[model samples]
Target: MLEKLQPNEIVDSIYQINLSHLKEKGIKAVIADLDNTLVPWRSTEIKDTLTAWVKDVKDAGLNLAIVSNNTSSRVHTLSEQLGVIAVSKAVKPRRRAFRNIASQFSLIPSEIAVVGDQLLTDVLGGNRTGMYTILVTPMSNHEFIGTKLIRQIERFFLKRIKNKST
Candidate 1:
């Protein structure tokens, strides 16, 4: 299971991604999961740190977009503040959402990076599509009921992977 990636520690909010590293890797655009990945799930507004980071990422010549399985209102509100387009109700771990987002950026899967906090959704989705996936720890563990349940299963698998590696 560790074969797919060298799992990384959380970047401490979206603001912390090393833009230079990303640029060196030819990552011209970022397609991110908005909820737990960018902010606490359902968070209404962008934080000051994130707001600035968004600009930094853009200024560094990287385009940004949000791919979320949320309502248009929620995604749009956040997208407007972050200066990025958003695809609401993105069915992740499936290629459809990624495909649509990629089209928006005029990018191929290889040139776009997907950032999120979940393993099964973000990591798997990006990996499936051959996009670089960055798994950041969620800002808050308190999430939707369904997510809480999925996270339980995700942790179980993660622990299993760790044990075998040890």
Candidate 2:
């Protein structure tokens, strides 16, 4: 169970992940989380820096999709702004949404990388679907109530995993 919760890589932020590296790894698609992972939770706009990152990934010939648990309106608005496909209200750790994105892109799970800020949602869900999972630190401490609770549980397990690695 714990192994399933672990991500293939953990990065400080999405900015640190290089699209060139992902391309070198043969990753054809990227299924990313919206809130916290891409931007601060509830933020409606994408800044200039993030826009450049998105452009870089696309320029590298990688498909990008936003799979978020946020409301459809929120997700749709942001996705439209970013010009990427999206799956909103995606109950993560569930393969349905992940599968949908993979199918839509016509790519196998192995060719995709699932990037997000949560373990239980992004990491576990991505791992279950056989995709490479990348976890990033949350953009801010200000989050929704449910996320706050999940973070507490995630921290406990993450701590244990760190200790075991040592």
Candidate 3:
């Protein structure tokens, strides 16, 4: 079943997350989303903070990679520059890319966390693959065509979260 996780499980921002804590939890790897999750969906340059974040992940002895639904060019550019593995045009929530990422890294699903801004694609995909999922706020109001539609649906679930929060 798709579990409705709390905000703590989702994390407020990428910087606030503690890799050591995740390591303690036996989470040794990460499969992250690119658009909005890491960048502004179309921003080409990586900020110092993002670069440092990736460095910290590696420094923490964690295997990391980018799994994006975007084309190879974009993911490859970002992944190569950041020194992480990548799978593009991922078609997420389908399990193909998620399974591939785990296999490539020789990581068990339980040992990985998938971080993304969208609940429908990233969160659902990660959960289906039995990985911990982190749903963050989108970097920009603009989203891909399909993602736009999903946001509308996500609001319904978010409303439930809001009600519970109150």
Candidate 4:
């Protein structure tokens, strides 16, 4: 059970992810979390660096999508601005959304990489669907109240995972 929560890779932010490395690993598409992973939690404000990274992902011949548990309006609005596919209200840690994205992209699970800031949601969901998972540090402290609670539990797991790795 705990193994399912483990991320295949951990990075400080999405910007640190190497596109070429992903390509080399045979990843054809990327599914990203919306809040914190892309923009700050609940914020539509996009950073120039993020725009450039998105462009770079496209330039490298990779498809991108945003899957968020946030409202449809919030997710769709930001996805449109970024020109990427969006799946809103995605209850993560479930396989449905991840599987659907794979189907939409016409790619198998192994061909997609799921990137997000949360282990329980993004990482667990991706792993459950057999997709490569990358975990990034949260962009800001601001988050939903429920997420704040989940973070506390996540910290405990993170520590255990770290200790095992060492």
Q: Weakest 10 consecutive residues, lDDT, candidate 2? A: 157-166
Model 4, backbone clash pairs (residues 3+ apart or across chains), number:
0
Per-residue lDDT tens digits for candidate 2, residues 1-166, read 9999878888998888878888889899999999999989988878999999899889989999999988759899889999999999899989999999999999999999999999999999999999999999999999999889999999998887667767
Q: Which stretches of candidate 3 lie over 4 Å from their true place?
A: 1-8, 161-166
| Cα lDDT computed for each candidate against the true fold | 0.80, 0.92, 0.84, 0.93
The C-alpha TM-scores of every prediction are 0.89, 0.96, 0.91, 0.98
List the candidates ranked by lDDT, beginning with the highest. Answer: 4, 2, 3, 1
Tell me the tens digit of each residue's lDDT in model 1 across 1-166. 4544333333655667788888999999998888887888778867787888788888999999998877659888889877799888777878888888888889999888889878777777887888887777788877889999989877876676557657
Q: List, residue by residue over 38-128, the lDDT tens digit for candidate 4.
A: 9998787888998999999999999999999887598998899999998988899888888888999999999999999998999999999
Question: Clashing pairs in model 4?
Answer: none
Identify the runs in model 2 with alpha carbons over 4 angstroms from their true place: none
Pick the lDDT winner: 4
Off by over 4 Å in 4: none
Q: Is candidate 2 or candidate 4 better by TM-score?
A: 4
Best by TM-score: 4
Candidate with the larger TM-score of 2 and 3: 2
Q: CA RMSD for every model?
A: 2.3, 1.0, 2.0, 0.8
The C-alpha local distance difference test score for the whole of candidate 1 amounts to 0.80
C-alpha lDDT (0 to 100) for residue 70 of candidate 4: 86
Error of 1 at 118 (Å): 0.7
